[model samples]
Target: MSSDADRDGDARPGPGRAQRDHWERTYGAHPGMYGDEPSAPAVRAAEVFLALGARNVLELGAGHGRDALFFARSGLTVTAADFSPAGLDQLGARATADGLSDRVTTAVVDVRDPLPFADASVDAVFAHMLLCMALSTEEIHSLVAEVRRVLRPGGTFVYTVRHTGDAHYGAGTGHGDDIWEHGGFAVHFFSRALVDALVEGWTLDEVIAFEEGDLPRRLWRVTQTRR
Candidate 1:
């Protein structure tokens, strides 16, 4: 586990580093901020994984382990990675308390960095809202490439992203690259073209539209397969 100081982002570069610090502080202030219920995307991802006989799942940007815990309970070994140490701490504690620690591992990982896993080592990868963070289009592409590198052949990748149709899409302070900041959080709203570009090297399974939260965040729940 990284020390709380390491998560403070004093030495890291880019706006992403600042976002990391924001998440760290946010998690510190409100542990389990997203609550414990598994996201609908996560629930659906688990079914896909299990149907494929997937034994392990890698969850990127796994804030406080809501979905990680759910995956574990559903009998998949889970690696939950997030940039926020405070969030992972809560996740770890919850796993231990629920006796799910044996199936769950936590790591402090920034998506801007390369994933720590070896190539073709992960059975599946799931990210609920990670790709829509304060990341450049190039950075998002790079991260998806990393996801491809780590996932095995025939592995599934399920992710969700806020889209241009969202109510908040044009309401926030623009940061270029389709990214915007609102209420101290930055989001890169996805366009359909961006989504199509990302599936170039993979088998695009589905892009289902959905809505969530009080703001009724408009999102695309995308599923693809490693080819």
Candidate 2:
């Protein structure tokens, strides 16, 4: 939770211990996992920013920099941070291959702690498919607080998370969730009321809950501005 820990160049154990370990093992076992595309929610949220002429975006939990690459290519200064070193490595490689090495900067840091950037240094913070899987409500609040701390007044926080109404909430998808085991961790499902309370100080600009494809998925798309 310390600022030094967040900006630390060295890796250290943090609050997201189980979540980090789960992703490390998951991505390690299947290096090519998740392919090389940004999540649909990420793409949609980025488009909203583009239309609004927002730049200097930061992506928390940027798994493999898929969305980071897209933002960079769209002419936004992007800083993508992830807790997993392996994920950042893949992101760097992908950026290099896509000729986006100059546009994107990859950082291996935990967002549950203080972020590396200076206060109010970014125009927007994007967290796609992040923040919902924390084992505790405190962790989720901490993550949201960090986002608010780094954003300037009126700055936007755009993110998506698995909806509580989804059928996969209690079911194990072979990728954690279900029961909280050693390798497996807790996944918190959020409802609209929960999200509203989480962003109390912020002005809610938009909220969308929709199902994607054939998977009984529920995605909460929230766009909020700092108060």
lDDT: worst 10-residue window of model 1 = 1-10
Q: What TM-score does candidate 2 reach?
A: 0.84
Which RMSD does model 1 reach against the true structure? Answer: 2.1
lDDT of 2 by residue, 58-119 (tens): 89878777788888988888888887778888888888998888888888776666677788
TM-score of each: 0.95, 0.84
Over the stretch 35-93, how does candidate 1's per-residue lDDT look in tens digits? Answer: 98999999999999999999999999998999999999999999999888789899999
lDDT of 2 at 53: 74
Candidate 2 positional error at 202, Å: 0.7
Output the number of the lDDT-best candidate: 1
